[model samples]
Target: MKKLSFTTPTAQKIYNDYFNRVSRCTRTLPEDDQREIMMEVNSHIYEATLAATPQTEVDILVDALESFGAPEVVLQALVADKKVKQATRTFNPRHVIQALYLNISNGVGFVLFGVIYLLIVAFGTLIVFKLIYPQHTGLFIREGHSFAFGFISELPGGLTELLGNWFIPVVAVLMVVFYFLNTLLFRLLKRK
Candidate 1:
């Protein structure tokens, strides 16, 4: 069996690169802590490399660093660990409520807008049906209805009647309902 040694210069370069990469992703660590973590990781890599066969030292070193995970992953794990520690210290109801409010308001606003858009589509379709097939306009409603409310057909010239009588009011009412529901949702989210 043969032995492989990493020269002092090679080791220095490897250690410096590791530290630099780790430091780039860490925001809260002091210089001392950062240096200590870098040293620990470098030492682990070196030890693993020594145990590998002579021809496998380079591969082992690379594998060890990769197994330690990327710099971002390391920083995230450290941050999460710190959070777990701090989370046990206190709980703030206001902050939780604020986060919940923001999330719910944004979610509900999207749903309300989508519903209003669909309603406008439905109203437009009704107008088109009334104009193209006035007799069949009542088909949209269930059987047994005595009168078919074909606003578009009721117009003097057809086009104006559709826009003026039914389509406009239906669209307006839908918009009002959408705005009211959105406002109510916003208030409910904020209250939570």
Candidate 2:
């Protein structure tokens, strides 16, 4: 097996890419610790390159480095090392927003799960309430304000009561509409 070598350009590119990705992913490591981790990563890359076959040096180096662990893993380990001083890190807006995007992409499933959970809770609560104090439920509804504003002067009292009964369904329709709008906004922001 022939010894491999990385050109200056290739080494620099690999180092910079690794550093940027690592910095973006982690918030714990001090500057010296981060530098040490990067140095170790570059050493790995260099060693892997020297061991690579004739097919491709870059590919082999990348595969070897990845096999060891991702840059993020290295950063985590370095941060955990006792020699490194621990500091409270604030969340960067870019990181927070990226996390939000990831969550929102998977949010439809989460929302559905939440809806089912909420339905179960509501049903249980209603059953318990009825069993404990059946008369109170009707009294509570009767006393509650059905509408945000009693503006429909022409409507009969029976019609108002029916509208009040449909309040939950109306809110459900609004929530569905808002979900679509939020999805659209998320897509647009991601593109930017």
List, residue by residue over 102-149, the lDDT tens digit for candidate 1: 233346653554455455457566667655765444322333343334
Per-candidate Cα lDDT values, in order, are 0.50, 0.47
Model 1 regions lying over 4 Å from their true place = 1-5, 8-15, 83-192
What TM-score does candidate 1 get on C-alpha atoms?
Answer: 0.34
The per-residue C-alpha lDDT of model 2 at residue 29 equals 46
**Clashing residue pairs for model 2:** none
Which has the greatest lDDT? 1
On residues 1-192, what C-alpha lDDT tens digit does candidate 2 reach at each position? 122345666855765676577666444445665566656666766676667776555676567768767766655444433121231122233432333433443446434433543454454454444445443322222235553322232343433243334444544555556545544543443344
| Cα error, candidate 2, residue 163 (Å) | 52
